[model samples]
Target: MVEALKIPTTLAELEALGEEVTLRIPASFEEYLEWVDKCEFTIEYFNNEIVIMGNASYYHEKLVAEIIFCLKTIFNKVTGFSVLGSNIKIHIADLISPTDFNADVSVVQGNPKFVTLPSGKKSNSKITNPVLVAEVTSKSTIAHDFGDKLLAYKKIESLQYAIFVSQYQPFVTVYERKGIHHWELRDYTRLEDSFVLMGQQLTLAEIYKDIQFEK
Candidate 1:
């Protein structure tokens, strides 16, 4: 009988291991991630590797739901806009072996009717050109959220805004594109504080609805 290998204990070691595994055969790993029999997990494909994500907490999900509700309500009054579920994969870079990242909630532009892109092409695999993207933070992902993912997201030509929400406390960070590859940042810590992205407003209080924090 063979025992499973223990995972690395520290972040640096784990990252090194992940790189080693990805360099071995990226296609095989990517295929397994998209397999139908795969378990329920929020997986991320970045830098030629798959990141297995754990289930979000109850509050985390609720916060996401509320934000979606707000987004839908706002888009309903507008034209050529819609929101996407977390399952939508986004090809942030080149289509060939592109790095796909799933936004918790994404705001896209489309006609009031269901959209059929150029030449009536449609896809469930991945999307690009989202104007706004939002992410709800978990304890393990704070650094990746602000560092690595932020860099990747800003590279999207059509991406004008990137927002990060905190589940552990009443906090939010809004990144607005300023110039070519330049982003201006703002942080909100008060419940009454709100962040505006793509002409939509989201208050911190509404995000933390029926939830409390240790801080």
Candidate 2:
């Protein structure tokens, strides 16, 4: 018989397991939030499972920073827009199962809305509204970034644009909400390529500035 996996009880134990490790052991949303509060690393909750997202790679971190910088520069003088980093947790509401994600970068128009955790406490770490969310994809997280996470981001009513950037290459994919249930996809592979986000033009050159890809 297959043995059941043990759930981690301490932050040290959870961190030792490393990144992208998904624990299928049954867990409640409250239990998952408790882990989120205790653990230093980022953790995701979905379908009653807790996924431990350990430290990102060097290029992963660099790419995320670059994207954030480019976005901030674009909206620096613009009002009613706030650029957020990965530290913020985005709550994906309207789904049957509880879902939360840490995007590489998030852009919110107007005031950001905070979500109440299952503990009945308000959390600044969690936000409910983001018009644009970006994710830096690596080999370890590419599946979740493009699959489950992408689908969940669409369900977020406040989300309009979802950007995915590759750490291994100068490639970026954008999903723009075209209709209530329709989305338009655009891909950029060259440094000169640019895309319109929230009516602002962003080129790949700026997003991948100072970024080197392995050949």
Candidate 3:
């Protein structure tokens, strides 16, 4: 949490910071996190902080499963890429704790490689690059998903598309990359609206198949 301390210019300060830097984490922190049941609390590393995600509602989980099934049908038959679920974290930075994202589902071009962490240890808990990321909005996370997280997801150089599916309605937003840093936004709400995401096509109705909303 400590930020903006003047960079140590002296040898003594360098030695002091080296020892103090490792003190930031308890020795058992990683060990505990590894054994923690994600079903209880979805934990993610955001910048330098650990973010505990709120639980998904039944509807949210159902939508996630449906969308994952649709994506698998397309990518598995044509793309030959790995289509993974939420537990797969994608590293977005190389900071102290690092910024990693856990999307509802991700269609990746290939499996991620082991990356050496700031602590000189290799972490096997992330997908370094993904092609498309999707999020099923929840009441507690819609704000971050539509705001900061959307911006962060675009910053991933390998990312070509970002899809946001509504949990409370039959709407979906797809951001397609046009060129370097250029993106096109398309929202599909009507059943007739066809989503042309990364050259693949699907109707909004197809995504919301067999799902009922409160009247």
Candidate 4:
């Protein structure tokens, strides 16, 4: 028996090697482990391809950190609700899609058991469904987040609110579930405007409070 060949180290190498070797498609956990082990590119194996993700700009990190801090403070006191940032792993096995997404901020209700797997350990698995999911858009992924990804995210039965926070503009586009299979889209830019979410109203000013920018 021949020894298993080592995987290519670079994306270019992998592309070329694809023609020669028959790869053993691994499970989600195995895929994640392989991805982490092979770090030539900042990529994630979602759907089928290796999606190379761009690094976060400083401004993006600041915004995400602030938002996470605010959410954590709010949810910690609310009870039955917990807040998480991109660090969390959200697994969707319906079609073998295990996406480790950076959910600028995600809130869920219930205490989830932490489980360890080959890929990584998840402290909260209760996030099979998120009550609200927000993505702070960037220049490169604005279209994906607002367009295609928005549609894809809508397929999630537990998703009630999908909010896209614009990086170019100081605005937010909210898609809220209206009925059984319908969603109502709304845009909010005004500071004092309140957006109702799961019976809780959040004012734009409150969410963006203390937020500063270059211009």
Candidate 5:
């Protein structure tokens, strides 16, 4: 854990760290927003701490693009659905520690409901409603993405599906909400495998398309 005060102020300085870093500092959400806004890279808020996100690898970006394309293709003709990229921020409220996260791919089934930051600033960048969220996991972020982040996403009232896709391999884990507190889990490893979300089917081949994994 790094101290927020010791963290670098510029994107270049932070990128010099060469990996994602979590800093613990006592600061208001307003300050966090201001700090992150100054940097060019992605930054996430979790439990009052700020996580300086690492740069995406080639495979990671490829997978993200593929997933977004597949999702958009599936919901293209559907009414009231939009697929979003990683740039959008998701506000996970009602938790002991509210979080602001950026998913690799997110799907909103209705007109997006935006929210104001704790600083009382209104921005379309922040969304509180998403029906589905996807994370492209890497070696450094696999744990947090699977653990605390997944739990926080499940808390979102509008969220019904959470998908975790591996960048290094052809594997994916999907969690479907079954009840108020129950979720059904499914894993897909083969390219031929597919899953249904919100009545639309997506194949693993579509997600891993154009991505090559090392043997």
Candidate 6:
């Protein structure tokens, strides 16, 4: 493993820095399993750089739970597709992505796989394919969660839509992947309107119902 270069700006610099990026020293997969069992902090490792995610707020948790519950109930009635919460893992290998970089909620096509090994370890990461994914944004991660991370997720072939829920406003931004290489952007600011995705639609007023927070 090489010493990772500090964040570089130039494309040439970034290309040069890539060689210096500390690739994960191949460790025993079993040992990683043991570490996962004991680790406490929710972390994400991408391209060898580790990112520590901050804690979620009360409103964040509440909104996440409500969305998952609603999706579970709705999808259960329409099809066998299931809704999974942050307890699941989504990983992209050599990608130096994160660990427990939980989406507020995700919909998977089949039985849930709790431990999704990195692409380097498995033929296909368990969470590589998600019908829809949601993130409850907070002040601490408004930028990355909405910008850079969203860009990374866009690279995923199986992701259909990525959602951003803001704490400052009732508005939500939904990015739906269109065709094969494009995304359709839609904004919902009206409290009465709802955003539809994958297969189900959820009203903003209902999703944020009874919840109050700093304006």
TM-score for candidate 6? 0.73
RMSD of each: 7.1, 2.9, 10.7, 6.9, 2.2, 8.9
Cα TM-score of candidate 2:
0.90
Q: How accurate is candidate 1 locally (lDDT)?
A: 0.68
Q: Write down the TM-score of every candidate.
A: 0.75, 0.90, 0.77, 0.71, 0.92, 0.73
Cα lDDT computed for each candidate against the true fold = 0.68, 0.82, 0.69, 0.62, 0.84, 0.63
Model 1 lDDT tens row, 1-215: 00123322344544544421321123432353443124344456666655545455677777889878878877787778879878877666544445667788988886212223334656555677788888988776667678768878988888888989888888888899988868999999998998776676778777777776533
The best-first sequence of candidates by TM-score reads: 5, 2, 3, 1, 6, 4
Q: Model 6: number of clashes?
A: 10
Model 1 residue pairs with clashes: none
Give the per-residue lDDT of model 4 (tens digit) for 2-88: 113444457676556432232333334455556655656333444553444455556666767766665666565567877777765
What does the lDDT come to for candidate 3? 0.69
lDDT, candidate 5, 1-215, per-residue tens = 33437656776776677755544465556667777767777778888777666667777887788899999988986778999999999998764566889998999987898987666778799899999999998887899899878989988989999999988898999999999899999999999999998888999988888788733
* Candidate 5 backbone collisions, by pair: none
Pairs that clash in candidate 4: none
- lDDT measured at residue 155 in model 1 versus the true structure, 0 to 100: 83
Query: Candidate 5: which stretches are off by over 4 Å?
Result: 1-4, 20-26
Q: Count steric clashes of candidate 3.
A: 0
Colliding residue pairs in candidate 3: none
Q: How close is candidate 3 to the true structure, as a TM-score?
A: 0.77
Candidate 3 lDDT by residue in tens digits, 1-215: 12232323344543554321311122233532442333243455554544445446578888899999888876756665778899777777643545667899988787666556556888776766888999988666777788757877887888999999997788899998888879999888887788765567878777888877622
CA deviation > 4 Å runs, candidate 1? 1-39, 95-97, 111-122
How far does residue 105 in candidate 6 sit from its true spot (Å)?
1.0
C-alpha displacement of 110 in model 2, angstroms? 0.8
